[model samples]
Target: MDPILLTDKESSGAFWPVDGDSSLIFLGTGCSSAVPNARCLLQPSSPPCEVCMKSLSLPPEKNKNYRCNTSLLIDYCHGNRERSYILIDVGKTFREQVLRWFTYHQIPRVDSVILTHEHADAVLGLDDIRTVQPYSPTNDIEPTPVYLTQFAMESVAIKFPYLVNKNFKEGQEIRRVSQLDWRIIEGNSETPFASSGLQFIPLPVMHGEDYVCLGFLFGKRSRVAYISDVSRFPMSTEYVISKSGAGQLDLLILDTLYKNKPHNTHLCFPQTLDAVKRISPKRALLIGMTHEFDHDRDNKILAEWSEREGIWVQLAHDGLKISIDL
Candidate 1:
């Protein structure tokens, strides 16, 4: 398949793509704190964060300064002409994101969900899933399928006991909550798993020195690897995403928390570029940005870097959608 690039104008059409093409939609593209930080707006620093100030002036749809938690939606189009919406990371801003992009894209419901970790920014919005669950004529709740690592599932069980057990008081059953069918990704992290008729290979990477988070390699012909939050990749995982590895990726979405300086739990811009160079994907988009970055300015820097390095890399913004061959 040839490299697929959809201009912003080309992607601003109807909700669904052509019958044969799959699309990757960025639901949000900011770190846990998100862009337009509250402190910047409320507290007001010496000069105020430029991005956050700009965010207040422009409409969200027109503002690249406004970003929510890092999340993605895969509109998977099968050969049978059927479509499935597979979402990654139901974060703290899930509801707002749904209200904005989901409504904009006319996505009726989510077919499945994939979790990267148990962090609040990644899982706090689990409760919002009830809104998008398929309707049941009999009034019985239809559970949404969710896949995550065993460790992540354990954390979720602890954090959301009601969601896990569902044993409520006699009259409390009337109180609606998210009904989830949790499926843990057991055994080896490198092994592949199936969800909504699509295959995904887990890429286990370090969140810090002690904690691990999952990234994924998915799709058929136009393969995409996504790692929204990661400090570093293990040697084994690095080998998998490396250019010399067995399979090459068409797109790589990675973490870029800050413009400079290293952090303990997330990749800064320079490290992100280093990883992109090693992975050698045909195209790359950096996500998980902070209020420090002006999206347009940073994206221009990325474009220049791409020209110099010959690896097409850029910053991903909320609501940006790309059509890919699958």
Candidate 2:
């Protein structure tokens, strides 16, 4: 089918494109420490975890059980040409994840990056973006655009001062300098933002006691909400979802770190199930999994639970892709 460009009007009557051939690829689906922990591999417990052992034994391409730090890639196309390659988080494993999934030949450039929070697992790879700067289709030699909340932006600046500083006097190679166009998102606001011709509404959700992480809702007609590291959904987020008028989403990617144990900052399986009930998405996929659960076993349980609950829910694995029709 031909890719259709979706156009919608803002409150001020300004029209923008919202429709396109969009596909979301799960670049990584593991927690901050990632799966198959080195510590776990070194010391063997009683009946060492078969999943982790197997993952270590096989190569990355052959191991479906291995995982990287959670992140996402939103690829959008208009007609025959690609429009946007929006990345969610660039964590410690960003380089390896990109090399594994995104080939140099297919996607030579990344249009933009949307940071969710300031955690090391979410923003540590900001500097590596320089690798794609030269391949930018615009050929302006300008910095690549990076969207983040005020808190996240500040945290990034503190972590990577060189990236934000335009007047660094150190003589360095052009490629070594961080080329980034920082865009700060306002606090406590659901203002819609545009990146690489795609529109996104920043849905603020709680991330433990001190952090407010931003999950994004993309596309107008068929929305896909990606909340990889959220602990709880804020009321304003629900209101925004309701106001969107779909009453349900095409896809909902949420954090499901543990099966029974709940963390102070991450959602457990039960909380993820509750979230699915609230959002009522057509399809739900759980991300940010730890090493405690094996992919095959956990997925079997999830499949059974999904059938019982009458909702389509599955565990998201690295490299999983889902196309959204808008």
Candidate 3:
């Protein structure tokens, strides 16, 4: 779908391809370092998205700067076609993650959005879903399902009241945009409902001081697990994750916030790698990292350390995509 065009100014050539379906694209991947500037001590020499870096030449405090939080969009499709899709998390960069991302591909719709927690960084961009919920082909109506835990609901309701549409009834439809719903990760209650196509089993991992973030296991393709903003994996977390087919994993998208001795609870790069080994997830890639990491430099170090050491490891970035034959 790459259509070549003549760019008389920059290069005389540019390709505008009709972005196909079934591609897993990275919107952003930093813990809280979404919008980095001189204040971000962590990334003294981090890489910036080409487009974003281009504007750095302009005077700061006057330029229209945009920041983003950590989030992931898993597009399930083969070749130029896609069947279903799911949004892992909607961080503060919700709007920018879309605007910044829209520059590349056009996301016409979303099946559902699964929030990891209620942190402002993770859920702030939620309100923007309004734009994606009006293209439903089912029931001749656009419906976007929001899945979250009871704890998240309590926090989100207070933050996003407009999304609640307080005036609507249970079965009523509002402009074809479906309201949010509650999902039970652990319990024995005939609650609202859940989806297996997501292949996500709950892993209550610790985050910050007293907060807990949800770690999900993407089950459709190969055994892939996603856990960001977590310190240690609970025994229950391990048990439930092992249930994703055969107590084995193919890919584990983990958090590598820090890289040293430790912090409050988040896993440093070294600690994260070790966890991957213990979990025995054949292959694991670091996520939710800061610009502090030099993708090429650090990745080489990790590759040398774990290449043939019975496990595979690598660093992730915005716009990077991976495909598993499972």
Candidate 4:
């Protein structure tokens, strides 16, 4: 397949295509509540948030500050003629995101999906996979494979019982369930999984007191690590990331939810900065921002910080795409 540039109004000159390489697209960059929160809009505070105010004023087409739930799309060439797409975390806005960013008619189907955790923002869009099953690129009618931890799988079954139970009572209509083949991942394990001709290593991290969230490392030559949500990382996981290429990383997408204050479950600005220093990636892009952050203003802050710290860092906006050759 030849290199094709994917562009939209917000990302017109920002994206460049590269052949025989892998590309990562940030479909959404908001937290669980999402930017322009309904409650925030309904109940105005003393000093209204300029970011939210600006987002409300601009039209949808021109607004770059409006964010949806966080998700990533990994694309790579499978062979001479086929292109493969692997989605990471299908959140609440998954359907709208695909509709807005992808030429759905041109693409055949998604290769696979990997879930990060059991959070509603991460797994609620599982049902939407049914839409793409009929258009399987490989012409296989088999179920779509979804990989997640054992705990996450159980949570899915509980949340969407209808999808798992195939036996229906008499006279009950057979609902068209999402064809899914669930794969269980063991905890605290770094297993190498293959999809769409690319290899990924699941890196486990701490998401609070009880939850364990996953991050992923893709490719061997042009290594990219994506950890969209994380409060802390275990020492072993840190070793695995730092062990690669003397701790040099081609790209690192991390979580930075707040500007100054820290959250128990998400990384704030100070924590994210410390993480960038420790990991020492060649380029770092911050994701999982809330409405409290103004894209243009916060980005300027990041630029100055990057210069002072001598590390490349920036904020990830919706529809942001980065290509890396392996």
Each prediction's TM-score versus the true structure: 0.92, 0.86, 0.74, 0.87
Q: List the RMSD of every prediction in angstroms.
A: 4.3, 7.6, 8.2, 4.3
Regions more than 4 Å wrong, model 4:
1-20, 59-62, 79-81, 103-108, 135-140, 243-246
Clashing pairs in 4: none
| Counted clashes in each candidate structure | 0, 2, 3, 0
**Residue 29 in candidate 1, Cα distance off native in Å:** 0.5
Minimum summed lDDT over a 10-residue window in model 3 is located at: 3-12
Give the higher-lDDT candidate: 1 or 4: 1
Show the colliding residue pairs in model 1: none
The segments of candidate 3 whose C-alpha lies over 4 angstroms from its true place after superposition are 1-23, 38-67, 77-82, 135-141, 168-196, 242-246
Q: Give the least accurate 10-residue stretch of model 1, judged by summed lDDT.
A: 9-18
Clashes of 4: 0
lDDT of 1 by residue, 1-326 (tens): 12223453222121223333788888999989887898887899987778888877876567777899999999998999899999999999999999988887778989899998999999999989988985554337768899998888889999888788866577664456787899988534458998888999888899999988899888777778899989998888877777778566778999999898889999998899999998898888889999878987887777778778888787888887788766
Query: Which candidate's TM-score is highest?
Result: 1
Regarding TM-score, does 2 or 4 come out ahead?
Answer: 4
Question: What is the lDDT for 211 in model 4?
Answer: 74
lDDT of 3 by residue, 1-326 (tens): 33111112111111212233344556666767553533543344365443245225444222222234667777666343445557877876766766655444566666778888888878877767655665453324544667788788878778877566457578965454334544535421123234425455666787875777887765555667778778877666766455343477766788887556577768888788778777877666677765456555676777676755666676666655444442
Q: Which tens-of-lDDT digit does each residue in 1-326 have in candidate 4?
A: 22223332211122223444566777788888887877778997778767778877865435557788899887776547467778889888877777755542244567788888989989898888777677544335677788888889899999888866666799987566677878886655457877557777888888886778999888777778888889998887777676343467777889989888889998888999998888888778888988878887776777778778877787787766666675
Q: Which should have the higher TM-score, number 1 or number 4?
A: 1
Writing each residue's lDDT as its tens digit, candidate 2 over 239-264 gives: 65542443677668899887789898
Report the number of the highest-lDDT candidate: 1
Q: After superposing candidate 1, which stretches have Cα over 4 Å from the reference?
A: 1-20, 135-139, 168-172, 187-189
